[model samples]
Target: MTEKTYPKVGGRSAKITLVLLVIVYIFNFVDRQILSVLAEDIKADLN
Candidate 1:
């Protein structure tokens, strides 16, 4: 029987991708928080 091996996830490109994803996730979280905090004011101003 033959075994199949997969590539490891410890390369430079992998590291860069992980960092970028984390940064994007953090930015999205902060943006949502800010929007939630301002939702009432935005609605009031629009109305």
Candidate 2:
């Protein structure tokens, strides 16, 4: 087992993960909004 005095995180993986999550959230919101807008049309067509 090797013990390190200090840990390095030059990769900034956390930042990358946050950015991707934000992007996916935005996409989900846009998709949900579009579906909501079309709800009236769908209801009318069903009857």
* Best TM-score among the predictions, by candidate number: 1
- Give the Å error, residue 26, model 1: 0.1
TM-scores for the candidates: 0.78, 0.63
lDDT of 1 at 34: 100
Off by over 4 Å in 2: 1-11
What lDDT score goes with residue 20 in model 1? 100
Question: What local distance difference test score does each model get?
Answer: 0.97, 0.92
Q: What is the C-alpha RMSD of each candidate to the true structure, in Å?
A: 2.8, 4.2
Q: For residues 1-47, what per-residue lDDT tens digits would candidate 2 score against the true structure? A: 89868777646788899899999999999999999999999999999
User: What TM-score does structure 2 among the candidates reach?
Assistant: 0.63
Local distance difference test, candidate 1: 0.97
| Deviation of model 1 at 7, angstroms | 5.6
Q: Which stretches of candidate 1 lie over 4 Å from their true place?
A: 1-8
Worst 10 residues of 1 by lDDT: 6-15
Question: Backbone clashes per model, in order?
Answer: 0, 0
